[model samples]
Target: MLEVNHISLTFNEGTPDEKKALQHIQLKLNKGDFVTVIGSNGAGKSTLMNIISGALFPDVGKVTINEKNVTLLQEFKRSNYIGRVFQDPMAGTSPTMTIEENLAMAYSRNKKRTLKLGVNKNRRAFFKSALATLHLGLEQRLNAKVGLLSGGERQALSLLMATFTEPDILLLDEHTAALDPSRAALITNLTKEVVEKTGLTTLMVTHNMQQALDLGNRLIMMDKGQIILDISGAEKQALTIEKLLHEFQRIRGEQMGDDRAILG
Candidate 1:
């Protein structure tokens, strides 16, 4: 359960390069709701995610999670309630750390540190079981440096690590965009499985129109720092890529048939 109320953010205000990245944006995601966000570059998609995850504070308005106000909470302080997987596989993981070590750190998040780096047998067993669920054979390579993993593997592990404790909200920022098509699909399916299995409330930003439509219970389209379209239930069920493209063109009053490069 997350509520973003009357949120707005701007960069370089009162300057020549001033820009309003989000304009009075408001969004509500119920518990277990998986919302897919799609927008062209500079449409405030990632900005919204950042605001929710506490990476950026809104110049106006508040963010509430599970009825607790976190608008002023620092990013690191929100880790107990928020989980995030970034666009870059390398961003969420330490390249030099071993797989189990990475997972151990995630597992130890929000807990009292004991100055002990060695993994206890029980924790190691849990990490192995968790990695096994990825089905990427990472369980066998718990001691291997994460840098040796492929991009997709690292991203998958990132997903697992982020959701290990089932935070109140999951923020996925174009997480699969860097992987190849096959790996992207793999991560996509894995995302759905993990979220559904854990009943994790999720907000995922994606550029691919088909992927946006094919996943999530609700879909939102944003442009020029505002939500232009919000579709769900029967409306989202009846929507198609062609209609979505048409609506985007109509709302922006521009030619988009050739803008697939920017949108997707």
Candidate 2:
């Protein structure tokens, strides 16, 4: 359960370059609710994610997880209960660490540190089983450095690491946008599988309209620093690319200008 209440943020406030990234944005996610977010460039998609993840503090309002205020919480402090996968394949993983080592670190999240080794016989077995679910043969290369893997492989590993601890909230910021279509599809399916299996509450930001519609039980479209549309249940299920575009035009009184969103 997460709540973002009347949060607003602006950069370079009162200056020539001042821009409002978010304005009185409000969102709430029930337990196991999966919401897909869509928007054109500068529509505050990633900005909203950053606010939730504690990478950026809002100028007003507050964020709460399970009814506890965390607006001022540092990103590291929130990491214990939040799992995130960035658009970049390299962002979420350690390039120099072995596959097993990276997984070991994720497995240790929120646990008290001790003198014990991060990886052992039991942990390795668990990591192997987990990696096997990716179907990428990473379980057999547990000793290999992450940098040597392909982009898709690295992203898959990143997804696994993010979900390994079963954090209360999962934030995916265009996690598959960097990969080829085939690989993107792979990661997308994996995302659906993992979320359903773990019942993890998730918020995913994506430019692809089809992807926005295909995944999640709910969908929201944002523009000009505000959430323009939020649809769920039957309404979300009945949505099509044409209907979504029409809704945007109807709400904003203008055409969607982002070509990527239109073609996606």
Query: Which candidate comes out best when scored by TM-score?
Result: 2
When superposed on Cα atoms, how far off is each prediction in RMSD? 1.5, 0.7
All candidates' lDDT scores?
A: 0.90, 0.95
Candidate 1 error regions (>4 Å)? 116-118, 257-263
Q: Least lDDT summed over 10 consecutive residues: which range in candidate 2?
A: 106-115
Candidate 2 — which residues are off by over 4 angstroms?
A: none
lDDT string for model 2 (137-211, tens) is: 999999999999999999999999999889999999999999999999999999999999999999999999999
Worst 10 residues of 1 by lDDT: 255-264
Residue pair clashes in candidate 1: none
lDDT of 1 by residue, 1-264 (tens): 899999999999999999999999989999999999998888899999999999899999999999999999999889889889999999999999999999988887667768886588998998899888899999999999999999999999999999997888999999999999999999999998999899999999998888888888999998879999999987888889889888888888885533653456
Q: Estimate the lDDT of model 1.
A: 0.90
Taking all chains together, each candidate's TM-score versus the true structure is: 0.96, 0.99
